[model samples]
Target: MAGAAPILETRDLTIRFGGHVAVDGVSCAFERGTLTAIVGPNGAGKTTYFNLISGQLRASAGAVLLKGAPITRLAAPARARLGLGRAFQLTNLFPNLNVLENVRLAVQARAGTGLDFLSMAARRRDLAARAEACLARVRLAERAHASAAALSHGDQRKLEVAILLALEPDIFMFDEPTAGMSVDEVPVILDLIEAIKREGDKTVLLVEHKMDVVRRLADRVIVLHNGALVADGEPAAVVASPIVQEAYLGIRTAP
Candidate 1:
């Protein structure tokens, strides 16, 4: 729908550390159930912007709003409780725990169940069933009992995704989701991400370096250069922008 109020928005969202302004007055919104990609060269403050919105980092100045309500004061866990889910650039997995245990624990926490793992482990059979469904969605059900450490790197990434799915958030944020996967593994992870968009209908914010992934999955693209929003438009137009081309995508001169 055109001109719909954003599901999430930042009002002059700014951040700084000493003299370095990491993100400078970035004001943008993600409409309901849209997948928006944040793309730029290293040091463009893409992840920092993500952190600010998701509550992993405090804004030096400005506000983060969810559905026209301010959430800048909310902490990371609080945001998660309010339907915000984040998957990090680095895999967040409990290596000593089995795949099922990892996801089940997230389900327990997301449910606001008490954190007495030792005492609650046996009684949370329902949580296990929920976790199984999450793993199945990510195609990790066959390795349900496999120790996270024993799984291949690609599977570990999938497990992390399963954990996020278990949280059942309304908004999903991903930071460099394919950063360390093998070439063969990239397509599988991308497929899962695409599936998440189609199946869950959740609002998505992604920080990704892969052009192919961004082009394929993003409904819109927001490009950053020097910690500021340089372009915001459809993928084809943004990628074709001379400003984006020169600053980040590299200008091409005809031979």
Candidate 2:
């Protein structure tokens, strides 16, 4: 088990917009079964880095490898098919569909069944059952019949996670997973992430601004500044480092 290759990796990954280099040449590897939290000041390119890796933004330079194979040219949907799942800062769902249908579609997609919803529903009861299980995991079973547009923002976020679960990817990338949720709604997502970590198979990459959440969930922490990887280590060590204290946490000790 020791020395297995990392499930996901970025090799000097970078991207630029005209004159600005949003994500500089940053490289890192993520081993399976570990949760790495990416933290930085606003505009430090954390989300941009995630976008490059997840194929939302193509890299201007460098390579992205999944299990050591280059996938830098792949599109977002291509990356998703190859086991990269991403949950965005804003909820992405079918506003017109009911809660259950949204997840059922994800299940159907993962099963390689065409999206003939009516036909699939008639032929495959297992898809619906699997979707229900994903919803229950996110505490949304009772709202299964509710329209996605009708649910509150917090519930919508939960439904997004359920959809991601239904896809069953090997790598889970969550960008600000708790950004807009109420305090009461934060724990459900956190608990679900903790459960994923407990599974000890899926690799998770989280981009978060909440220090408390990072402290509680990250197995390791990586700090970025000015579009570069500034620090990488255990949570306590990274958080306590002088660079992070001053730049990220806004703690300035006397020179």
Candidate 3:
């Protein structure tokens, strides 16, 4: 009788560091099957807001809700267990492990299979199959045996996405998914993200600075400035708003 609750919601979420408020009382709701881009200039708290929601930083005030349930107090791993997945701006990886091993670990974690090296051997075939499938999706299957640390920046980014895929989260949070990638390597990641949006069952939140990428992928856009939400609307409207144009896009109208 009632409509389904939003996949994620932040209610006046605030976080202060020392004397400054980094993310100031921002409230927004994200629905299923929509991609919302969070855009702002450097130091606008976009990533900090993401850290709070993903449980990397504690919120000084307010709450984070997943499917209408409060998860503000949960730690990062706990939140991940609750279906909140985050791919960082930096490539977070097991540098010592080979690419396949890194992804297999995520698969094992998601399947509730503890990381017992000896026991893992018994389940290697199945877990590796699943992990390889994820890698294939991101075009990293050929690098399965290579050390994750040795991959190029672009490949590392792809491996991180593969790991995220292995976890099968309901909400995908990507922080600048294409930060330092090459011109040639950028499209693979973008195509993967586009495919995710096309799935139409997952909720996606992206913090990106590239206006073109935002325009192409975002269903909605919300702007943040000085840790506070400044503008929110359809992508074109939000990007063209005077406040966003001045604060984020660095565009100033002539008098």
**Which whole-number lDDT from 0 to 100 does residue 185 have in model 2?**
87
Point to the candidate with the largest TM-score: 3
The local distance difference test score of model 1 is 0.87
Candidate 3 stretches with Cα past 4 Å from truth are 115-118
- Per-model TM-score versus the true fold: 0.91, 0.95, 0.96
Candidate 1 per-residue lDDT, tens place, 172-207, comes to 888887787789868767887787789646888889
The sequence of per-residue lDDT tens digits that candidate 2 reaches over residues 199-219 is 999999999999899999999
Estimate every model's Cα lDDT from 0 to 1.
0.87, 0.92, 0.92
Of models 1 and 3, which has the larger lDDT? 3
lDDT of model 1 at residue 197? 87
lDDT score of residue 103 within candidate 2: 95
What's each prediction's clash count? Answer: 0, 0, 0
By TM-score, the better pick of 2 and 3 is: 3
Candidate 1 has its poorest 10 consecutive residues by lDDT at 114-123
